[model samples]
Target: MTYKEFMDSQTQLEAPAHLTPLLEALWYAGRDEWHRAHDIAQDNEHDPMHNWLHAFLHRQEGDFGNAAYWYRRANRTVYSGGLREEWQEMVRTQLPA
Candidate 1:
């Protein structure tokens, strides 16, 4: 789904059926369920998308150093600021509709 659409469609418990693992992670993260997001992201560590989402999850959990490590694994620069900002950037720049 489009990033905006995903943002809008928050009435459900599970991730959209068509979304990838990274998207699933993003969905759970947006709902403030870091553990759920982390579970999905951690399972697919070989993928850069997984690494990025995993990093974001760690960031949400207040683990900055671990987040930085995963960001490096994802080949992304470390980020700071509110979770919403990071989530929007990741959704817009990393995921597909």
Candidate 2:
């Protein structure tokens, strides 16, 4: 599945408000707007989803090391995890090749 599809599903499911910012971050990340995503992710410290988003942004910006670190800090996983691979892949594709 694509990142946009995953995001759309989350939106359709009425995902948590805390995760909303993460979605926004993903939206910005999709557009290669890391700063905007980072800005959105920075506002929420309490949500693991926010950390996941931060990690994704770092990954998208080519900071693979910090991205992994943040993902770990965020306790990221697939099932029941804060963020999923499809979305992460979406973010990943935004980075410069």
Candidate 3:
């Protein structure tokens, strides 16, 4: 899936079943379902990708300190961009060519 495809999927009632957990979380995030996204991220805490998603969730929640911690855990730099831009980047990175 491309980033445009992923974004387009948001118009549906549910996220596509083929998405990875991180992508599902991003899907939920796009819909403003923060708790669902956070749950998916927290439940998959062992993966660096999930941690990065968790960081993004915290950042979106306006909890910068928690976001920083999760970013460190994920070995990703704390994102300084707008939430929408960061979300777009993450979705694009996870999507298949």
TM-scores for all candidates? 0.87, 0.57, 0.93
Candidate 3 stretches greater than 4 Å from native? none
Global Cα RMSD, each model: 1.8, 9.2, 1.1
lDDT measured at residue 87 in model 1 versus the true structure, 0 to 100: 87
Q: What clash count goes with each model?
A: 0, 0, 0
Please provide, for model 3 over 1-97, each residue's C-alpha lDDT reduced to its tens digit, 9 standing for 90 to 100: 7888888899999998888889999999999899999999999999998998899999999999999999999999999989988888888788865
Evaluate all candidate structures by whole-model CA lDDT and list the values in order.
0.83, 0.62, 0.91
Among all windows of ten consecutive residues in candidate 3, which has the lowest summed lDDT? 88-97
Q: Give lDDT tens digits, candidate 1, residues 1-97.
A: 6767888766786677887778778888889888888889889999987898888888888899999999999999887678789888878875465
Candidate 3 at residue 32, lDDT?
86
* Candidate achieving the largest lDDT: 3
Candidate with more favorable, higher TM-score: 1 or 2: 1
Residue 35, candidate 3: Cα error in Å is 0.4
